[model samples]
Target: MNLRRILAGGTATIFATTALVACSSSDSEDGEGPIRIGTTDASKSAWTVFEEQAEARDIDLEVVNFGDYSTPNQALSQDELDVNLFQHLKFLAEYNVGSDDDLTPVGASEIVPLALFWKDKDSLDGIEGESIALPNDPSNQGRAINVLVQAGLITLKTPGLITPTPADIDEEASKVSIIPVDAAQTTVAYGEGTPAIINNSFLDRAGIDPNTAVFEDDPESEEAEPYINVFVTKAEDAEDPRVAELVELWHSEEVQNAVATDSAGTSVPVERNAAELQEILDRLEEAERNA
Candidate 1:
């Protein structure tokens, strides 16, 4: 993917500071120390396979798990983690814009469809005037709204916005109202008989089969570009060969099998190069700034 030139000729400025820490894996000899990676899904079996694959290549890896979405980038920026692989470009754009950071994606990962689950309802029909549950976070909330729009349940005041929020909904024209809840609690709301937009991470933990979703957004659609997951590191470390190697390892057959299993066959693996990912991130960051 030529991750060595992630931001080469890109719009974002790269700082000239030295390494964040003296013992950073970037500075260490090959396999000298563990490359610390922050993720929200360390317990997923895919990560175990990823770790074993890294070991096979003499790349020591330490998987640091985070409980929430807010901390991984902070940990990476603070030099506590070498990289993070949890969020999509949209979420990362929001974080980068909000925090004024330039962490860059080194490779593209899979995109899992954000799906609607209902405990009682079998389809989108008969849900008029119903309260739908969605993740309260801006990124997921916006995507959830789009999912409803695609399902013919809602309409937006302004069509085609990348990160539309609940406020952007044309409530007068929409058939259903939204109830924003924590991402982890969407399953709870679903169990309570509310049709919820559940992210893949929370689906498996709650014992929900992703394939059983009543409705789901198409992962390969143009609107899904912002939702493509990625492996991100500080912009300064973008060119590290080891980082590229780690990204390549993630696509290995064994690791991808685990990923498919972990995501219950919902994950659509993507293969965008570093420059392509950076271009997407740049566009998202610009939209975030204007929004």
Candidate 2:
């Protein structure tokens, strides 16, 4: 059972011309073909375990790896892939509303804490009035802003806005100013001696230690619901039992252990049924529409 992997780049332009493939279905009663799933974490050992487990159940699985956050959804939306497991509720909401699509989440994975990496500073102390770089993407940018708020470095005008922008920052009340850069550039900013709020995905590539973060949001907190990574598929396929089985398999001790090891134990496993996950996505979509 060979697991095929497709490596994409950070830019969407590289994926723009990808030829559309036949849409996949979770209901494979005839044992048609492999159920192809897209993800950014294909290199992780957890996926190898997942594939092995799926093969044991006579489930043909193919894992297509993506580099950028944009293409998986695009491929999924275009019916080129069956399902993708790379984003959280907030990111999915943003993509759905912005693209006018209804790609749905079928299972909850885990939430990896976003952290503020300061190569120089030991803590948030004495960082007042300094510039901190963060991901500019809508979903992460808002979360990044909240991390600062949680760190007592900044205050938002709307108090508890989960997806606030830089304009929403109460400049006079905040201790530090935010520099919104491309998501990948956060490390570049940090490398240049500026403090950066980076996503866990970029940590390994940048050789930044996840434990070195001066501050990080609590993954177990209720406020972290929007950040829970999910297995997403087309809305029509949300009720597929095969997909649900695959989701459950992800929580198996073997796969879960591999996931924890891959993320350096920073990834907190979460268990929310499809309905609960959908409710969170709905609320986030509503907020995104309003915003």
**In model 2, where do residues sit more than 4 Å from their true spots?**
1-32, 78-80
C-alpha lDDT score of every prediction, in listed order: 0.81, 0.84
lDDT of 2 by residue, 1-291 (tens): 545555554455345325224234444323366677888878889998998888877777777777777888988886667778988888898899999999999999888999998887778777888999999987789899999998888998889887889999999999999999999999999999899999988999999889899999988775688999999988887886778888998999989999999998898999998889889888989988887
| Residue 218, candidate 2: alpha-carbon lDDT | 86
Q: What is the lDDT of candidate 2?
A: 0.84
Q: Write the per-residue lDDT of candidate 1 for residues 106-133, one digit (tens) a residue.
A: 9988998889999866677888989999
> Native-vs-model 1 lDDT?
0.81
Which residue pairs does candidate 2 place in steric collision?
Answer: none
Give residue 49's lDDT in candidate 1 (0 to 100).
84
Tell me the spans in candidate 1 whose CA falls farther than 4 Å from its real position.
Answer: 1-26, 29-34
Error of 1 at 133 (Å): 2.3
Question: Candidate 1 at residue 230, lDDT?
Answer: 97
Estimate the Cα RMSD of every predicted model relative to the unseen true structure: 7.1, 3.2
